[model samples]
Target chain A: MARQPLRKVGSTWKPPGKPAGQAQAQDPAGSKGEAALVAGLRAGDAKAFEEVVLRYGPRLLIVGRRILGNEEDARDCVQETFLATHRSIGEFQGRSNLGTWLRRIVTNAALMKLRARRTRPEESIEEFLPKYDPNLFRGGPRNANALTPEELLQRADTRKLVQEAIDRIPGSYRTVLLLRDFEGYSTQETAQLLDTTDGAIKVRLHRARTAMKELLAPLFDEELR
Target chain B: MREFLLKLLLQFRGDKDPGPTEQRVGSWMLRHLPGMLTCPEFEEFIHDYYEGLLSAKVRRRFETHMQLCPMCQVHFDSYVRAIALGRQVCSDDEQLPEGMPQELVAAILLARNQDLDS
Candidate 1:
């Protein structure tokens, strides 16, 4: 018999009967509640699996969107993450938090999607990176102004501005910045995930960050005055 | 300080020139000797400095340059802010539950169920 598809539950539909705030209990790895949920998942409990989806799906989707930047690709990768998790549930050792584990899957899925979707050679980000005079101490003039990102925190458009600047970065470095800075992956982890060496990741990450600094100069300078 | 380090380098290469300052190089008082790093030089080390990969002696020089050189200070501050902004907007766990399309969830379950049944 073919399994039935789920009916539309509207936007307010949560996992079975659990309230919203307590849903975190179902998601955090290694917690007793989550461990039991893991057991149910391993036991092939359909409801338990649905609970996991409803709890973690949105965040994973957000991660996918941030990583892949295309709606269809992001959604497809996120869906694949859930399927992968289901297949591999019994093998999870709980060393990493469950959320972290799922995120890793989603990120990898998105990266694979990106590889498949690559249309052209990646652009060089050298022009975007910070440039200083080749000589020492003569790096232009001393500006009395020091602009910090902390000052932009209260702005309503800060996130939008930052996102737009990030969108402008070439893929090669932008991916590194997102993985190292945003995804909280260490250099070694990012290197391993991206199939690159740690030294390569470090160089790309620094260049990416330097480029971002150059790209966001307007906003930072706006706060400076 | 440049002359002091220069003379020390000369001595290490086995060139014989006695200097009181080269002896002063290893003294506890000279431990904080700030290197004369130009703005461009400091820029190169910013990544290493942030990663805590620089030796204490080098870090003192980096910090000293940053404090005394406002240009490098601005550059370094902006670099730090750029990372903060990127992280701010890309936080992994920022979930808007209401924003998740219910249809996606429906599709995922449908696909999973079909996978197992087959």
Candidate 2:
């Protein structure tokens, strides 16, 4: 007869009344709250996971939309991102801000999705073209004397032009610019998210900005003069 | 004062590389061009004067320079194009290619969660 395995159920599992992670503890002493929550999560406390989702859901949504270029996909990415984050909570090495680590995961997920759905083959030359020519403006002095707001809206179509320029950038460069310029991530933050060095992010961002400058030249030719 | 200003302007002069001046201007332009150039108010009257957005008095003076200045014209045109293109590329309304289905989001999440549990 083999010895019966010890059935120490009550000790290994959390108390029935305790909130699933470190969150139920006192107000976090500095970073201790997050640390506690992470610990609870490691212990399989479900509530700790919920707190993580609540904290990051909105920020991640914006990131997803910018990366994926659509609202619905962004929302989907957030949900999946949190779930994945939850699964890997045990292995989280605590070497980074949880937000940064989670963001890295979300960014990778978004990139993977883009890669999977993209129709173009990897490394195709045609993917590098400026998506639209910036010469859409009719050549002529815009009638400046027309002072009405409606007239300006009709003639300028400023919003549409901006979108077209963004569309024209190559994929990697485009994502870098979007993260830096639109989403307001720092060079270091973006580097972490993309899993690249800060030097690489800087180089890519410079190229993106230069490309953006070319696209915008026609619009501002008059202003700079 | 006018003589000093002219000397300063000469360092940014269109005919030559202006070397360091161009780099400074490039950095300044990168940050501010988006806001400064997008106004239709400036775009409408840009062609009447070579330096489209300069004050009338300033434009009157630059006009004389531009008459013989091909470099200024080309550089100015390139800047204009860049601002216009920047606005277009970053605009929000641009459509995305079709995305993963809602079901896929669920499937992926569920699969990941299950893996964690196991």
Report RMSD (Å) for each prediction in the order shown.
15.1, 20.5
Q: TM-score for every candidate vs. truth?
A: 0.78, 0.47
Query: Per-residue lDDT for B1-118 in model 2, tens only?
Result: 4334444554445444334454354334422433222222222333333222357564534432322222333333443344333433333222234444446445554655686679
After superposing candidate 2 on the true structure, give the runs of residues whose Cα lies further than 4 Å from its correct spot.
A1-33, A121-164, A179-204, A218-225, B1-118
Clashing pairs in 1: A137-B38, A137-B39
Evaluate fnat for each of the predicted models and list the values in order: 0.61, 0.14
TM-score of chain B of 1: 0.60
Lowest-scoring 10 consecutive residues by lDDT in candidate 2 chain B? B35-44
Q: Which candidate is the best by lDDT?
A: 1
Cα error, residue A36 of model 1, in Å, equals 1.5
lDDT of 1 by residue, A193-220 (tens): 8999998998888888888877777765
Model 2's i-RMS, to one decimal, reads 27.3
Residue-level error in angstroms, candidate 2, position B39:
27
TM-score of chain A of each: 0.81, 0.57
Looking at model 2 chain A, which ten-residue stretch has the lowest summed lDDT? A15-24
Best by DockQ: 1
* Candidate 1: residue A11 Cα off by (Å): 50
